[model samples]
Target: MKIAIIGTGNVGSALAQRFVQSGHQVSFGVRDASSPKSQKASTIAGTTLLSIEEASKLAEVIIIATPPEAVLSLVAQLGDVKNKIIIDTTNSIRTRPEPYATAYHALKEITKSNKIVKCFNSTGFENMNNPIYSDFGGIDMFCAGDNKEAKALAQNLAKQIGFSECWDFGGDDKVELLEKFALSWINLAIMQGHGRNLAFKVIKRA
Candidate 1:
């Protein structure tokens, strides 16, 4: 997969490194390649740094790991994304794109693209860096979207990064619900001091 990560923050860099290690071609799309964050992400082997537009053009999949509000301005830079798959890994807990409830909503409406999915937002960057636990093996991931193909691709990417499963949260209406799920993790891991080493997994009895 030719993946373009739009941010170079903790979550973005973590996924980028894991994806690169999984043998996928990764590129970082940034406002300034020389910026500290972008420079740091560029240090990852087998990855390239390019302007936002350039990176978007070269990628088959575009992962938005930036702040939720950043998607408002990114609409213009994400040229011809109609044929590409967009995986939104943001939660609008602190700030959302105006006129839209979430970054996923903003991207779908502004870009008029149906191939969008909300994913990789339900846990901390530590989990994304390493989903495997000594006991549980691989933690589960969750994704929500209306497009079946888009959701399938998102689930595949999650597994490629060592997630055991990428459960389907639901259709478009469940996007916010998934964000709220992320908040639950934040509350436990940060507010309640449960520690970032924790993760969630679904259990079933056969």
Candidate 2:
């Protein structure tokens, strides 16, 4: 998969490496190609740095790892996202996108694409970098969106990166719920000091 990650922060960097390792072509999309974040991301093997518009145009899958509010500004730069798969990995915890509750909503509205699912935002970047935890194995991931094919792609991407499972939290209405789920992770991992090493999983028995 050709993927362009918009944002070179912790979450973006971690996913970029994981995707690249999983045999996906990864690139960092940014306003400034020479910025410290972009330059640093370019150092990662199999990752390139391109302008936001340029990167979006070239990739089949576009992952927005940028801050929630920034999506408003990048909408114009996202170009014709019409039918591409856009996995939004941002939370509105610190900053909502105003008219939209989260980046998922914002992207869905502005980009005019239903192939947008919210995933990869539920845990610390450390966990995403390497989900394995001794005997426990890889941690679970979660996503929510209306498009069936989009959700499947996101789930497949999750599994490709060592996530034990990618639980479908349900459709569009469940997006905010998933974001809140992400906040729960943030609260416990940071606020409660339960540690970032902790993760969530579902156990079922027949």
Candidate 3:
């Protein structure tokens, strides 16, 4: 999979490295290729750095790990991505894309693409770096989107990077709920005194 990560922050960097290590082509879409963040991310061997438009053009999937409000700008810079899959990894808990509830909502409205899946936003970046806990084996991931194939691709990508399972949180209507789920993680981990090491996992009794 040719993947374009639109941000070089903690979440973006982690996913880029993981996907590249998993044998996928990972490219970074940035405002300036020479920026410190971009340069630092480029050091992660096999990762390509290009303008937002360029990276989006060549990648099969584009992950938006940027601020929620950033979609307003990206909607124009992204060119035509109607045919590509977009995975939004932002939460509206902190700052939302005004008018739209979450980044996923913004992207869905702007791109009008059904291939938009909301995943990778419900946990801390540390967990994203490595979902596998030495004691627990591998933690679970979750996604929600109307497009079955798009959600399947996201689940496959999550599994490829060590997550035990990528549970389907539900379809598009459930996207905001997933964002709330992310806020719950944020509340428990950051606001409630628990450390970043904390993660969520479903337990089933049969």
Best by TM-score: 1
Q: What digit string (tens of lDDT, one per residue) describes model 3 on residues 103-157? A: 8888988888878999999999999999989888889899998989889999999
| Sliding window of 10 residues with minimal summed lDDT for model 3 | 31-40
Quick one: ranking by lDDT, best first?
1, 2, 3
Model 3: clashing residue pairs? Answer: none
Give me the runs in candidate 3 sitting further than 4 Å from their true place: none
Q: For model 1, which pairs clash?
A: none
Model 2 per-residue lDDT tens digits across residues 14-111: 99999999999988899887788888888899998998998899999999998999999987998999878999999999898998888898898888
The alpha-carbon lDDT assigned to residue 37 of candidate 2 equals 82
Segments in model 2 whose C-alpha atoms lie over 4 Å from true places: none
Q: Tell me, by lDDT, which candidate is best.
A: 1
What would you estimate as the lDDT of candidate 2? Answer: 0.92
Give the whole-model CA lDDT for all candidates, comma-separated: 0.95, 0.92, 0.91
CA deviation > 4 Å runs, candidate 1: none
All candidates in order of TM-score, best leading: 1, 2, 3
Instruction: Report the candidate with higher lDDT, 2 versus 3.
Output: 2
**Residue 55 CA displacement from its true place in model 3, Å:** 0.3
